[model samples]
Target: MFIDASTNSLTVSHRPTNAPSGLIESLKQYPTANVGDAMDRLNLMDTGIASQWANGRCVGPALTVLTREGDNLAIHRALDDAEPGDVLVINALGGTTRAVFGDLLAEICLAKGIAGVIIDGLTRDRAAIKELGLPVWARGVSPAGPAKYGPGAVSVPVACGGTVVNPGDLITADDDGVAVIPVERAQSVLSRLADIDKFEEDLRVRIRNSAVHAAAPAMASTN
Candidate 1:
């Protein structure tokens, strides 16, 4: 429920239900690098979305929002509708002069159990967000605030950071970058990521044992 200050009344509405199961938790088991590798093997491109921070990781289904530049009412609406395992994916037309979100919003997301936030625009209060442990993947930061008015849509498809994101699509982000997996392909992608992780682990072991070096003479000769 939201308050209509103009009328001094409380407004109530139904919250949108989130996707039941996308194996969100399972996807969290693999880092974004492994997921990216799996996407490559599947002939998928445009999965990477750059992150402003290098330490935080997020995994969840997307709750997409598209808002006009310098306005954030749609982001608030999305926050209200987002479930515990939902990632707020906002497309602000790549606006950078004004911030679409900040630490106060991060606090609300934390309290609401939101998995994370990915914005194709700027955010503020970066230090506070990191201290609060809210995973945010954004392009830049600005001290400028936003206007509340919005002519935007929620739970709709949005282009974020050069990638098309649809509501309920599985999203994962880490130090490497962000990756989106179609909802229907989430399970298959998860399996493939696991295989990739295993193969990489084996390769790492072989490298540590000097086997890879022994098999490549030119590389050994350089050393």
Candidate 2:
């Protein structure tokens, strides 16, 4: 497909549909930090994408978009073409001066049932976005708007948040941050996260019990 550079026309291919089912639900049981710990056990580095949500979490397969700095034509195309439960993982080359998305586009994503947006650039309309309750993770927020003109591609592998995101890769984000699990590694990562969750829970209980035991001696001495 040919894109018109003059118009910033976008050519989008179908997003991959083979994401593992139930993994997203399973991931939701743990925080992004726990998930990151699990990925670390496998030597996967942090995604480095900051979570911008006023509330709630985001979990889904990625629909990758690669665009020129300060341009978001491909992002608009990705929104139109992405399936439900797909996170629009955008690589804007780490441009921080211009916001690639705003409240208006976020409304479109909500209406279309997009899981969330993770931009490696900037976003605007922070107040409205928080009110609207859309999960948005980005490098920063800028009031400067992006140009529609683009040299970009949709549904292609892109470097986002200091990580390489391929279409259909599992994207999980929350108050902590975002993490990308490769499509081929989702199952193993999920299993590891489960183990981590259990370990953390046990540690929490042990710490509480020890604290109680330590305080019991002081209480008895006072009596």
Candidate 3:
């Protein structure tokens, strides 16, 4: 996504995953597109890690999972320790040969009130995942299943979708893609987002007015 699934060890590191007070609420008001704009496009996951369902959006602190190439035992372990509103961000090493997640895991996340998932590798059960309405962004899907062996770590920084995601980073994802904001920088990012919002709103007004202006001459000539 490997080291052979047969040879992988397990490591777990627990750390604080809480974002700044009001940070989640502030972030919820913006989309990943706008957030990316605010960050000068430096904060986004790669375009390939896209939403598994239409209209899926999520904002929460990440609970990072670093797994051996083709195994997901660490993902299961991460789920056991997840807090409400945590987004399980797994670095599966980009191996798409097997699907490391599916509907059952989606169900578990939903039941546990976890925010969503982002995988650097692949997943399965596209239809069922959509049916459950769990927000997921992954490289793609595979019908093949994953190995459930240890040799993975939870709450540690790992690479995902061409970026390194640290545990407790604010993960904002949508149909457009995913963005990871370090918790320490979230409030600053929020302020920047407001400036971007204003700028975009002004641009949108101008864009719409230009459309109306462009159509007027045609309407006048037709009349």
Candidate 4:
């Protein structure tokens, strides 16, 4: 895709090299918690960026977008180049007073086959977005609208919910929150997920077999 060089605002960066086919499906099998464990919890997005609807979960390559706080012209532009199953991982500087995008944009994501969106800023129209079944994780929602200005970039490295997201980084998100897995770490994380799953299952078995408070771990993040 051509990056439009005509304007100082609304710049574009190169897209990421694609990951293996079916990678998103493989990552989807594990929940965010297991993904976090596999990465030593260092790449997980902050808990503040949470699901806007119940039962929301998705995994896809990041199409990173960076915009000024409370603005979304670049977000609309990013969709033009989005491939099916791409997830828009947007960094909006965590602005809360106004929304960067809302249900109207989400409908576009659905039409484009985009997997979902994770925003470091806010959005409105939660009810309508929930009805659309387009997964969205954001800091919060506000009724306020956003400015439609440029000065943002698409397909660039961006920070969302405290995690540095590069284009093509795998975004694994669910009820628990989002985890970012750089392409380089994808294999290592996949390798460790099984061990984390097994250890967790074994602990569940232990808790089930025992009948006392002591059956639980001294400290556990599993609850």
Candidate 5:
């Protein structure tokens, strides 16, 4: 089963099963920042290049995009193709000169129950985006406008920030960064990330009162 871009309808690959409970809870435990650490341990395969552009964190399934340079036709089509618990992933070819997402698009996403958007390009309408409280991660923000000509693809695998993201993969983004958990490996990865988070928490508690000393005598501060 697949989502048809023209009609904006959902078709399940399997039976409409609920997302894993542990995965959802793990998303709550580790903020986007801590997840980045986990991805680093996993060799960086489970991550996205998303810069935080809003207040809260975003964790949901992905709706991948492959768009032409300077045009967002594919992205618009992806939005129509996305499901309620979907995060739009746009492959913008690292173009940051023009804004690929803006107020109107965000409004449409919010109304349609989209989890958030992650673009490898620029975004505009900063004030409205913030006001609407939609999660957006992009290369940067720009006042420049975008073109409409589109020879784009939707629901296809696309490279974002040197990482390949496939449609329906789990995406988590927040103030720290973005991480992609492949649908097949999400459960195991979530468990590993949980253990890493716990260890970090313990380390933080131990380091609270510990004093650092320079190993090199020459580098030590002397009063």
Candidate 6:
């Protein structure tokens, strides 16, 4: 469970056998819902730091990144150490002053099999990112540059888009919003989400039939 401080790498001993199935399926149900609802159910913050460039939904495992102000050495390091099917979670101190990612970063991530990037910071090269068809969730866009300073970490716990993302956790993002499911509780939450989805579907059916009541019945009716 220990990660190398210098290398910022750790062999994940406990891989979720489910392959992030539950929420992934839930996304199918509410194709237009934001990923933030699921995150709120899991007690996550809505960092308001994301935007979609790709057309479809986004779902994958997390690769957390923490960096000092205007510095992305750790982010660069994380990418080098990134594995396939990873979602890069960047904790950029909520700084919208400079872009932490751009066309080059998006290109690198796509080539490495990274699912997406969710950053609590700014990003540039908007046209290029959109052109590349990469999924990026960030606070905003800026043309400012980042510093190559010290004090940063990767593959560790980080807060992005108002969620606490631990390395190897599951992240599912879409036009709805971004949601983070803990690797430990993913299955259970997914089950609950399924039930919610079913109930909502039934409700929709009733509404379509004009069978839904406008208000509660009178107290006398309870008798």
By TM-score, the candidates rank as 3, 2, 4, 1, 5, 6
Candidate 2 lDDT over residue span 92-200, tens digit each: 9989889998998898888888888888889999889889988999888989998888878998888886678888988888877778888888888888877887888
Position 5, candidate 3: lDDT: 43
Provide TM-scores for the models.
0.83, 0.90, 0.91, 0.88, 0.78, 0.77
Write the residue-wise lDDT of candidate 5 on 85-129 in tens digits: 678888888886788778888888887788888888888897788
The C-alpha stretches of model 6 lying farther than 4 A from their native spots are 1-40, 52-56, 211-223
Candidate 2 deviant stretches above 4 angstroms: 1-11, 41-48
Off by over 4 Å in 3: 1-8, 213-223
How well does candidate 1 score on lDDT at residue 54?
57
Native RMSD of candidate 3 (Å): 3.8
Candidate 1 has what TM-score? 0.83
Using lDDT, give the best candidate's number. Answer: 4
lDDT of 3 by residue, 1-223 (tens): 1123442467878768498648897899999988887778887889989888899888999999988767788888788788889999999999879988988888888888888999999999999999988999999998998888767898899889988789899999988899988888888889999999999899999999999999999999998
Instruction: Give the alpha carbon lDDT tens digit for every residue of 46-160 in model 1.
Output: 3334565657888888888888887777777767776887888888888979998988888889988988898888899988898899888877899999887777788877788
Give the C-alpha lDDT of model 2: 0.80
lDDT of 3: 0.87
After superposition, the stretches of candidate 1 with alpha carbons farther than 4 Å from their true spots are 1-22, 41-49, 211-223
Predict model 6's lDDT versus the native.
0.69
Model 4 regions more than 4 Å off: 1-8, 211-223
Q: Report lDDT (CA) for all predictions.
A: 0.77, 0.80, 0.87, 0.87, 0.71, 0.69
Query: Of the candidates numbered 3 and 5, which has the greater TM-score value?
Result: 3
Candidate 6 positional error at 216, Å: 24
